[model samples]
Target: MNQYLISIYQPDGPTPEPEILEPIMRDVEAVNAELREAGAWVFAGGLFPPSTSTVLRLKDSEVLTTDGPYVEGKEHLGGFTVIRAADLDEALAWGEKVARAITLPVEVRPLQHGACQ
Candidate 1:
């Protein structure tokens, strides 16, 4: 089986208020349950915003750590799901469900290797 990553993208901005957030989270939970029942779920979860990120680099044999993502961009990964499927088509099917649940664009890609990556 090929492992694929189904990433949910949220444009940079203030997060939605709970009134908006709660329903989406519920929908996402429903999708997660369906994936679990279908055995298509490996793992999935939400993430903190980009502001909390820390980057570490090696310079002159010393570790240099910085705040923020590797690169500055308007978009950062909002959340992700990892699943094992027979092929890209199967993986994309999963992505479709996720996209619908979150009402956002989902970026799907096959991992180079299963588990090791």
Candidate 2:
């Protein structure tokens, strides 16, 4: 089986209030449960906001570290799931479920060689 990354994207700003966010969290939990039950879950997690990210770049043997994400954009990866599936189609099917559960955009990509595939 091949491994896929299901990346969740959200606006790069504050999240909704707890009252508005609880349902989303519940849905996320349900999705995780479903994935586990289906034997498709390898790993899953929510990430801190982009502001918490640290970017490190190496050029000509010099390392440069930055305080925020590598890219300055309105949309950021909010979280991700690594799943093992039979093929790209199966991976995309899981991604659709994730998007529906979280009510957000989900990007599904196959892992390249040396990337735990």
Candidate 3:
């Protein structure tokens, strides 16, 4: 099986109120559980807002560190799940479920080298 990354993107702004977010989170967890049951789950996690990111760049042969995301965008990667899938079609199938659960755009991409440690 190949490993895939299911990337979840969210708008750049304050999170929704609990009433709006709680159900979404519940659905996300449900998907996570399903992945575990299927033996496809590798790892998954949510991220803090992009504002908290620290970017590093190689400039003039020196590493330059900057606060905040590498790029400013209306949306940022808010979370991700790494899973094992038989192929692209299977990975996309899981990505669809995650997108539905979060009500956001999700990207399903295969890992280039191999599975994660």
Candidate 4:
């Protein structure tokens, strides 16, 4: 099985009201459950906002730490799921389920051999 990253991106802004977000969370959880049942789920998590991110880089032979995302964008990675699939088509099928659940864009990419081993 190949591992794939399913990235969930959300607009950079305030979170939606509970009334609008609660159902979406429920749907996402449902999809997660399905993945787990299929033994496809490796790991999944939701991230804090970009403001909570810290960028680290090597500069002038020194490590520099910068607050916020590495790059500013209208959308940022809000969450992700790592799954094991037979191939790209299988991974994309799972990605489609997540996108439908969250009503947002999802990016699916394969992991390199022995990655995270």
- Model 3, 22-103: lDDT tens digits are 9999999999999999999999999999989999999999999999999889999999999999999999999999999999
Worst 10 residues of 3 by lDDT: 108-117
Candidate with best TM-score: 4
What digit string (tens of lDDT, one per residue) describes model 2 on residues 21-45? 9998899889899889989999988
Instruction: Report model 2's TM-score to 2 decimal places.
Output: 0.92
lDDT value, residue 88 of candidate 3: 95
Worst lDDT run of 10 residues, candidate 4, spans 108-117
Model 3 regions lying over 4 Å from their true place:
none
Q: Model 3's lDDT to the true fold?
A: 0.94
Which regions in candidate 4 have their CA more than 4 angstroms from the true location? none
lDDT of 4 at 65: 96
Q: What C-alpha lDDT do the candidate models reach, one value each?
A: 0.89, 0.90, 0.94, 0.97
Give the residue spans of candidate 2 off by over 4 A: none
Candidate 1 worst ten-residue window by lDDT:
108-117
Better of 1 and 2 by lDDT: 2
Residue 31, candidate 1: C-alpha displacement in angstroms: 1.0
Q: Candidate 2 local accuracy as lDDT?
A: 0.90
Query: Which candidate, 1 or 3, has the higher TM-score?
Result: 3
Q: Residue 25 in candidate 2 has what lDDT?
A: 87
Q: Give candidate 1's TM-score.
A: 0.88
